[model samples]
Target: MKIIQNFTDYHEKTPLALSIGMFDGVHLGHQSIIRKLNAISEKKNLESAVLTFWPHPRTIFNPNDDLKLLNTLDEKTYLLQKNGIRHLFLKEFDEAFRNLNGEEFVRQILVKKLNVKHLIVGYDHTFGKNKSGDFSLLRKMSDECGFKVEQVEAVDFHEKHISSTQIRNALAVGNVKEANEMLGYIYSVSGKVIDGKKIGRTIGYPTANISSDPLKLLPKKGAYIVEVFVKNRKYKGMLSIGTNPTVNGNSLSTEVYILDFNEDIYGEEISVNFRDFLHEEIKFENIEKLIERLDEDKKLTDNFIF
Candidate 1:
């Protein structure tokens, strides 16, 4: 997909069919809207495009919240390209851009900038200052603005609506299965292997310390069955996200022990895909007890599949 970073940088040859949102996780609901957008674009012979924000608006408005994101910019770009989106207008969400009100946003951005001929939006999507823009506003101005607006009903699983917030909540509590179901893909984290205390090596379960994105949302502090991708190869593993209390450590760590694998992969970038939650992190009485628990975790991990 052609990624347009600034609103002024978007120069389209044909009228565009577009949807605007932060599209944080680009969960199943977001995918549904994108699919509909592509269909409309194809039928109208217009370019399928997405207008998204960077550095997430929440991080700006809620500066002290330390907002965590599901997919980083690179990951979101890859996913959008995989979904066959033709264009991506990724604009910075700074104070000046955030001040654009409903009508101004429509005239200056949707109509003037992107030449959007059709708009597909999630049922509850809202934009502009104080989020005053909604489906009703779009429909009311469609005729004057010379564009069509579509509001897709929320995609639900088991009668519950799928949303980025829902997915994030699931991950926050180590509900990987629920999160993945809503995401329509495995929930994964990527990082470079870093040096650690090397405590696991002494217990026959050497682990690779992961230095993941600080802004990425981490699953609950626990042990989980996971697949680690290293050098483009996937290996089954048991992953731990915790502060090593047994060793009097306080720093949170993400470490994975790849089953039946042994190699020095320090400084290499890797991805860890969570498949299942195994157990919660605990404060073992001693190193021997922790090792014993890990052995059991390995057996349980071996039988896990998702």
Candidate 2:
């Protein structure tokens, strides 16, 4: 997909069938809107595009609020591309850009710059300063600007609204199975393998430590049965998420010990998909006690495969 970082870089002459949103998790609701965009683009013979923002708007508007993200920029891009979006336009949500009125945003960015032929938006989508813009205003502006508008109804699952907040809450409480059900896939974390104290090796369960992205949200501290992917190969593993209380480490860490395998993987980028939560992290009395618990955890994790 062609990624336009700003409106200044949008030089395409062909009008685009566009959908605009934060699209944080790219969850099922976001997929519904993107699918509408794809269907419209195919019907109109126009390029499918998504206009999103960085700093998430909320982060800029409410700096004191804790903003945990479901996917990083690279992960969101990959998900958009997988959903048949051909163009991605990302705008930095800065103070200056935040002041644009609803109509001005439509005129300058959507209508003039992007030449959006059709806009697919969610039912509750709002924009402009103080979020004063709503679907009604967008439709009015689309009519005035001579463009088409498509409003997708909010998507629901199991009679409840499926949302990023709900998914995050599930993960925060260590409900990996519920989170995966809402996310349409296993909840995964990606990061670079980093150097760590080699204490796991001495205990017989060698581990690969990952320095997780600061922007990505982590699940509740616990041990989980997960599938580890490295260099295009998958391995069954048991992952611990905590501050390694057994070793008296004070810093929280995500460490994965690949079962039945051992090799140098430092500096390699890998992903761990959490399939099920095994148990909460506990502090062991000693190295021998920790080893015994690790052995039990491994046995419990062995019954599940991802």
Candidate 3:
């Protein structure tokens, strides 16, 4: 997919069938809109396009909150590409852009910049100046502006609507199964393997410490069964997201122990896909107890694989 970083960079000849949102996690609900977008794009012979924001609007309004996002730019790009979008307009959200009203956003970004011939949005979607736009406003604008607009209804799972916020809440509680079910895929994070205290080596577990994006949301602090990807290979593993309380550490860390494998992966890039929540991180009474718990973890992880 072609990524258009700025409004000036947009130069598409074919008018676009577009959707706009943060698309955080690009969960099932977002996918419903995307699927409709692609169908309409193909049927109407327009370019499939998406206009997503960066740094999130919430991050801007609540600067002190350090609001975490579900997908990084790179991850979002890949997911959108897989969903069959042709053009991705990644607009930077700032105070000035936030000031645009619903009509202004339709005129400027949708009509002027993207030349959007068709627009698809989620059921609860809102845009422009305090989110004053909804399907009603969009339909009225479409009638006046000479473009087409569609609102895809929410995708309901087990009587609850699938949404990004719901998925984030699930992960926050270490409910990977629910999150992944709503996401329609494994929820994963990518980061650089950094040097740690080398404490795992002495215990014979030798973990690869991960330095993930600060803006990216992390799962609840606990042990988990995970799939690790490194050097273009996938491996089963157990991951920990918590402070090393047994070692008198107070800072939270993310590290994974690759099953039946050991190598120098420091400074390498790795991805971890959470599969199942294992146990809450425990502060063992002694080193021996910690080692014993780790052994049990390894067995459970191994059995999970087999």
Candidate 4:
């Protein structure tokens, strides 16, 4: 996909079938809109484009709130490109950009800048300052602007709409199975392997310490069944997320012990996909007790089907 960073000097001669949103997790609901865009673009022979904002609007509006995101910028970009997006337009949501009203945004950015022939938006999508723009406003202006507006109805899972916020809520409490069902893909975290206390090795279960992006939202502190991707190979593993209380550790950490695998993978980048929540972090009475729990975790992981 051709990524247009901001509406700086780029211009598309061909009319675009466009959709605009932050598309945070690019969850099922977001995908439905994109799929509609793809269908419309193919039918009308228009260029398919997704106009998204960077630095998340929440970050700019609510600076004090430490908001954790489901997917990083790179992850969102990859998902958009992989799922048949032809153009990805990124608008930096700074103070100056935030001041644009509904009419101004449509005229300056969509109609004039992108030459959007048709706009595909979600049912509850709103834009402009204070989110004053809505389907009614867009429909009213579509005639003069020489464009059409189509709204995708809410995509629901088990009666509730599948949303980024819902997915985040699921992850916050370590409900990865529910989150993945809503996401249409496994929830994963990617990072570089870092050195640790090597405590697992002492107990016959060596682990890879993953140091992920601080902005990445990690599942709740606990043990989980995971699929670890290392050097393009997949392995079943049990991941522990917590401070090692039995060892008097203070800082929280993520460590994954790959079953039946032994290798020095320090410094390599790896991705871990959470499958199921095993148990909450426990304060074992001693190292022997901790080892016993580790054995149970491994047994459960072995039986965990992908």
Give per-residue CA lDDT, model 1, range 32-77, as digits (tens). 9999998998899988999999888887888898789999889999
lDDT of 3 at 65: 81
What tens digits encode model 2's per-residue C-alpha lDDT throughout 79-122? 99999999998999876678988888888888888899899998
Candidate 3 lDDT over 118-189, as tens digits, reads 999888889999788788888998977879988899998889999888888999999998899999999998
- Show where candidate 2 strays beyond 4 Å: none
lDDT head-to-head 2 vs 3, winner: 3
TM-scores, each model vs. reference:
0.98, 0.96, 0.97, 0.98
Runs of candidate 1 with Cα error greater than 4 angstroms are none
Clashing pairs in 2: none
Q: Pick the candidate with the highest lDDT.
A: 4
Better of 3 and 4 by TM-score: 4
Please estimate how well model 4 matches the true structure, expressed as its whole-model Cα lDDT. Answer: 0.92
lDDT of each: 0.91, 0.88, 0.89, 0.92
Descending-TM-score candidate ranking: 4, 1, 3, 2
